[model samples]
Target: MPETVGDYLLQRLRDWGVEEVFSYPGDGINGILAAFEKAGNEPRFVQSRHEEMSAFQAVGFAKFTGRVGVCMATSGPGAVHLLNGLYDAKLDHVPVVAIVGQTARSAMGGHYQQEIDLQPLFKDVASEYLVEVNVAEQLPNALDRAFRTAEARRSPTAVIIPADLQEEEYTPPQHAFKHVPSSPPSVARSVVVPPDDEVGRAAEVLNSGEKVAVLVGQGARNAADEVRQLADITGAGVAKALLGKDVLPDDLPYVTGSIGLLGTRPSYELMRDCDTLLIVGSNFPYTQFMPEFGQARAVQIDIDGSLIGMRYPTEVNLVGEAKGTLRALLPLLQRKQDRSWRETIEKNVSDWWDTMEQQAMLEAKPVNPMRVVHELSPRIPEDAIVTADSGSSTNWYARNLRMRGRMRGSLSGTLATMGPAVPYAIGAKFAHPDRPVIALVGDGAMQMNGLAELITIARYRKLWSDPRLVVCVFHNNDLNQVTWELRAMGGSPKFEESQSIPDISYADIARSLGLEAIAVDTPDALGDAWDRVLAADRPAVLDVRCDPEVPPIPPHATFEQMKSTAESVLKGDPNAWHLMLQGAKTKVQEFIPNRR
Candidate 1:
């Protein structure tokens, strides 16, 4: 059926239903590249600008499609470049498989060109499964195991093939001693449900309390309806983990958006006031954002037993699929008749939105960063997918953008790394070519690698059915997030050499590449600029010059943080006066009465 090991490898990947393999070319994968040409590109090779971008594209595809994403790279340095994106998948619990080339078996002991010990190098990142195929017979089993393990464990896995072995004549593992043959490529599916007794225990804890709060994470994505039903019955307010921002629509009356530093004020108040807590499919690590110890009776539901009872002291831990487990527990949970708690939550949520709008409209030197997302929120299409990078802008994305009508949003959540947003948008475009995709990135992240990814988007623009893919760059020439962190956490002033970055025209670069580009410097230009960019016939870039002095103050700003920030400003921070003015103006919105 196949002439070489490389041909068989591509065939097997097709059998596994892989549609695209994000990759970068090199001589290390020459055999596989040849096989791709022979196979007529059955599993299309989507080339990225760099090996790291390829890995990020795979991560993004897997995240959006809910399927195992595959990536390929050459040996030595190419393989080494994939580590950051692979670690991003690992930390965020996304399923991805990396196929990498290695030096020939003959070059194993000898330090030939592009030869390095790959197994030990990848051992930590691909800890779920890592294998190097030394023989033709080992190819099928190793590749199959990598795909299976990546899906089953929801982690990145690796299969390393020596350069010489890939060109060898294909051979199947025979029914002989010491030979292992893999079954056909298919994953068996099953729904895990916790025992009846555990469900009953969880229900009892939830039904006993009057003031209940529900916290959800990305793991609860499949259990959205169940989560909503449970919240409705319990008169509970639901708060989403940053990773679970799309799990529940923000329009719901009792849905307090996002919990943590870059979270909403309503979410902070919800956790502080609730006497009972129900956690579903979220392993949010911040204990400070959660209810105080010994204050709330808690019940947690998760598919993995190991993750349960680790974040909070739960009265009951039910280990099962989130949707199924919640389905089991819902029947036993008695609906709380009192509506006062729900009313209070709804009121707090309503006021928070008004405060957000007021803050977004505040005057700034050039543009208020919040207004960029604020304008886009209502204008964004119903079925659009949004990606945000790790920066001060993530605060706006988390608190400003409202999820409704099938909108999906994600960021580097646990890893919180820079430079994935634009690549993620490219991957999202591949996943659903019919849907419009948007990426919000700060200047720091945009400079890091996003500028290069625009070329990747430009090259692949014709493949998508919908041509609208927008990369909105927050053109604040500063590493804004870390700068604020230094002030708030380390009590240090902004070190200009380290914190300030050069301002480059991202719009000019996009236009040179023949993509529609818009540069917005004034606050008034943002809404119309969003309109023009979203209506473009091709991939576009919206570069908005924003005020760096604007602070991303946490909802529940600690007294110590305030003191530290004051200290940093007093210590001769360059933007000291402007920062103080912006911080005070933004923080005052919370105390202002809702005009509505």
Candidate 2:
């Protein structure tokens, strides 16, 4: 039905509802690229600077749309480069389809250039589905399976096309392996409801304990109303995993912000003292942040049955979709009459926010990092999509940025990879140009993968109807998060110099690429810079010179951490004094206990 296998593949992609395909061109993929040019451009081809960025962009597309984001690369090196981002999709349970070109069939087993066994190379990452097309006839079924498996399993899938096969004419078989649909296949995500017995048992465990804490993850994002109802009925304090940042508004009374090192003080205290833990859709890896294995009677609910009780010992485990499972459990749950537990956690949450506000206002030589996020949060549009790179910027985003109303956003969740923010923002903008998209990245990550994507942004910005994407680069000139973790992990402050990055002007680099760029070094100018960037007509970058010395202090501190900070200061570290002032000033107030 098509001139070539390549054309057929592109047609299948369009039929599968893929509007854009992120890719990096190479000689091995020449045929597919040529076919894309000939396809009349309905499914637009986006050329990314790096194969990895293309994959990350695909990941971002999947994250924003909840559909199979498609990406393509050449054989050997280009295909290999997609592994990291593909793993990000797999580990985070996002749907993605990666098409990789291979050496011509005649060149196979002869060790030709750019020829590697891609099946084994891609097997682990695209664990759900992977196949190589040896002949033109195999293309349709393989492509169909790729999309279906990616959707059903919610993981990355791969289809490898040999260079020769891609150029050959493809004729549909009268007796086809599978029915090639005339229209787009509608993959329905059916509601998975756990059995009545499992639901009843979980409800019982939750009702038996007085102090309940509800921990949620990305799975519960769509069921915020149900989550709030559960928390209300059970007198539970809701603590979100980093991926579930938008599950509940920060202003919610019983919400404890986030959990773990990047979490809020109220979250730590609530987890430490809770009598029962009702975990919904989160396999929170940090066992230390949760109550002792058996200390709290735990009830865990998740769509994937294998993940239940993987993090904590559970008294009851319900295997089902979060929204349906939660809806089923709410009616069976006994509403806790005691408001004291809920009030205590809410009071702590309020105090933590107050402390954060004070820290945000503290004036310093270089602008305080928290101050930048503080200024930006209020200006974010209600429907904006925000992505944060993995580093100190994530710390500020996790602790400072507030997601309210219908606003949605995400990061490199399970992979926690850097260099995703910029590309993720680009993909999100492409997915929904009507909504504002922002990327919060640190200097280190910007140097790694942020700059190349600007070229991609510049290329496609005009194509977007409301291309108001913003890249907020935190120019701290160091891998600040790693430095802080080194100090917090009982290491000395003297080693920080080795990790220091050179002073780089991201705004200058952005301006060179034809993006409207501005650099703000002073605390006073940060707000105005953000306003200008938001109000700009095209894609822009706002580079803020953030303080490298300030550490992202965890909500709860250990004596070892305190000693580490003191030891660093005693050793004459230049930024140690500011760290001490920032950390100890409020700690005294917290430990002193207000004398009424």
Best by lDDT: 1
lDDT of 2 at 274: 94
Model 1 clashing-pair count? 0
Assess every candidate by TM-score. 0.99, 0.96
Compared with the true structure, model 2 gives a TM-score of: 0.96
State the lDDT of candidate 1 residue by residue for 205-268, as single tens digits: 9999999999999999999999999999999999999989999888898999999999999999
Top candidate (TM-score): 1
- lDDT of the structure predicted as candidate 1: 0.94
> Model 1 — TM-score against the truth?
0.99
For model 2, how does the per-residue alpha-carbon lDDT over 1-596 read when each residue is reduced to its tens digit? 44987888888888888899999898878888878889986689899999999999999999998888999999999999999999999999999999999999999989899899998999899889999988776677788888989998889999999888888887764566653433246686699998999899998898899999999999898788899999999899999999989888887878888899898889999999999998888978998899977789998989888888899888888999999999999999998888999999988887777777777777765888888989988888888899989998898899888777777779998899889999999889888988889899998999999988899999999988887899999897888787777677754674656777888788888899888899998999988988999889989999999877766878877889878867766776667777777666545544544333
